[model samples]
Target: MRDNAILVVVARFLIPLVMLFGLYVQFHGEYSPGGGFQAGVLFASAWILFVFIYGLDTGLRVIPQRVIYALASLGVLLYALVGLLGVALGGRFLDFDPLLDAPKAAQQTGIILVEFGVGVTVAAVVMLIFLLFARRRADTVAAGLDPDAADDVREEQQ
Candidate 1:
């Protein structure tokens, strides 16, 4: 797959479209069937597909693990901060009515922020899970370690 020029060429063109559609879904959920969760999964799938077509190193270069963890924490914090902000504005937790002069505007803004935060968190977690699983499998395969053959391996070493 890595060396397949056709696949690589198609991916280079298609991955961005997938990402754009994911973003569209992220924002369009208010009026449609998609939402942060769906968008996040779409984004994560694109990243994983990119990795599969390219390589782990390339994927890591695009988005390092440290950034992923930071964003994961940041997303939760962002969501929480939005709630706290509402409280500070003399409303209940997550009360968006006080976010702006117009209650409708406030509600929309708050909802957007909430969705963005959720999307970020989901994307980060999914990417981390995929990367970890992919890395572990690669490691086991590379090390010639089979879980079922562990006893045989130890016996041979002995």
Candidate 2:
């Protein structure tokens, strides 16, 4: 993978652009068509592309599995805390009216926070799933198994 100079160069150029787009989508979501989910997927896709080009071990080294797990937990906690804040402010769960002096400003703040939380959670989960599958494939190959051979054998059996 590292031997391909063109791919390496293109990836170096595109990965940052992709992440930048993800940020744009995240911040502009409330005003536009996009939101947390789209942004999160974009972010994950960028990382996945990096892994494909650089190799799984390198990807893991860049963003360890433990950090990904923590991000997932942190995102959820952030989401919950926002909702809880509404309750603490004497409103229903997720109510943004009581969040600030101005109801409109409060609503906007709440939406942004919630959306950010969703984005974080989605990105982490996607990365986690990809990492697990990639690790499994690595292990299969390490064990001297042709990963695709199982599928071919299954097809023959059927």
Candidate 3:
């Protein structure tokens, strides 16, 4: 993580802008090339940038890992429930015709729900993966077992 004031200032300025763009991608996905996956990545990157500027501990304190896990699970449940709703409404699985009065509107609503579910899960999982790797790397560095350290030692010996 950087201790530089300029870096922190820049990150603070850009985080909101990037997150807003991610939201745009999320909502405008149906009519544009961006979608849940892209939006999720974008959102995850915003948090990750914060982690980079600050530290993992700070980031986790801001949004605990338990919450992230819950969000992931909730996303999956949301997707499943939307599909189940169609079935419960006397239609096939994921058949959202019964969700609203207009078929087009119902389908769009279903799609949006599904996309949201995917975005949530994807964002959480990405953050989890990043946290896992960052923790491990931090530990390795702490223990002085990092591969980069080994390479450095070898170079010094040579």
Candidate 4:
């Protein structure tokens, strides 16, 4: 994808930092207002920024859709598994006491794990949405059509 040289350099430096911040938010959520949902979106937003400035194909090649889908499913599964642990221990859903035999530290650990799962799923889903929209726009452009053109122009010729 072609972009101004300065913008490319800036993005290269910024994206990694943004990803790191997301990780921090995910891990430190227990003591802060930010948590899985916010961290996930932030992580996905960095990727979206890259895609928007460069192109969808570049983004797809960097992070394939299949991988994203897998990650999303895995995240949900992880969260469900954690909750199941609580159920197996004869507690209500997501009850942390069962996670570690009623130890507060263990319960905190369980919560962190579940929160990470949520963050992963949310991030992957958001990225997937951005990918879909960007890909559609790229397709339209490749067909020699402006995305914002009138509906009549976008219609296929008989």
- Displacement of residue 101 (Cα, Å) in model 1 is 0.7
What's the lDDT for candidate 3?
Answer: 0.91
Q: How accurate is candidate 2 locally (lDDT)?
A: 0.92
Q: What lDDT score goes with residue 136 in model 1?
A: 89
lDDT score for candidate 1 against the true structure: 0.90
lDDT of 1 by residue, 51-142 (tens): 99989999999999999999899989989999999999899999999899998899989988988888899999999999899898768755
For all candidates, the clash counts are 0, 0, 0, 0
Checking candidate 3 for backbone clashes, the offending pairs are none
lDDT of 2 by residue, 69-142 (tens): 99899989989999999999999999998899999999999999999999999999999999989888767756
Residue 72 lDDT (model 3): 90
Local error of candidate 2 at residue 90 (angstroms): 0.4
Residue by residue across 11-112, what tens digits does model 3's lDDT show? 999999999999999999999988888888899999999999999989999889999999899989999999999999999888889999899999899989
lDDT of each structure? 0.90, 0.92, 0.91, 0.86
Off by over 4 Å in 1: 147-158
Task: Choose 2 or 3, whichever is better by lDDT.
Answer: 2
Q: TM-scores across all candidates?
A: 0.89, 0.90, 0.89, 0.85
